[model samples]
Target: MTIDIRPDDLTSPEMAELIAVHAQTMLASSPPESCHFLPIDGLRQPSVSVWSMWEDGALIGCGALKELGNGGGEIKSMHTRAHLRGRGLGRLMLDHILSVAKARGYTDLWLETGSMDAFIPARRLYESYGFSYSGPFGEYAEDPNSVFMHLHF
Candidate 1:
């Protein structure tokens, strides 16, 4: 599949569906208090850069990078359509996010994900890309259901 990942506006109808699915998945995987998936409107904030992957003109996945200032960034809203999982699309999206963070001069990249079994693959993927376990950073607070990871360039 020729997947095209590009910056996208969160207001698109396709994006709405993607974000809704992402939100639903997060909620299903974690408690409401532990879910950090940002809503579509939040992803449109000036500090967040959103990207969507498309193949044959159909949206297949999406991810975002949030500028944290002081040369830091946070990965947010990363999700692949349920049918498209295990196809290396998540890795491709992550690689794109890391490249953009580097090009933007971020010295560190951080992310928060669920600590449940469902998130093991994601944690492994981040580890393969050099992200290591870390304490909560930025505005995040300690949460048993959350796992934090970071990579420094």
Candidate 2:
């Protein structure tokens, strides 16, 4: 199973559907105030770069990297199609995002994921990649429903 990860313009219908599904899942699992996944408009900002993962011409997952300036970056909108979980696609996309961050000379990477039981796998995934618990960065405030993490290169 070859999976291709490439830059996406956020125009494809499949991508739109995936983003909606991602949003729905996030909203359902976490409270509205704790959810931070970007909407399509937010992901389209010049500071953000989005990528889609595909297998055999079908969209499988998507993730984004947003530059926060001053050598800092943020991970956003990471989602693998529900049916395709456990296939290591998230790991692949994460490695891809890390490579991009390194190539851009980012000194640090931060992310905000839910602290809910439903988010354990995501937290574990980030932890596996060296992301340690951290105070909120960017505009985020400390919240019980959110788990903030940082990885420094």
C-alpha TM-scores of all predictions: 0.98, 0.99
What are the runs in model 2 whose C-alpha is more than 4 Å off? none
Residues 70-101, candidate 2, lDDT per residue (tens digit)?
99999999999999999899999999999999
Pick by lDDT: which candidate is best? 2
Model 1 clash pairs are none
Put down candidate 1 lDDT per residue, 1-153, tens digits, no spaces.
689999998878999999999999999999999998889889989999999999999999999999999999999998999888999999999999999998999999999999999999899999999899999999899999999999999
Weakest lDDT window of 10 consecutive positions for candidate 1 = 9-18
TM accuracy, model 2: 0.99
What is candidate 1's CA lDDT for residue 43?
92
After TM-score superposition, what is the CA distance of residue 120 in candidate 1 from its true location, in Å?
0.8
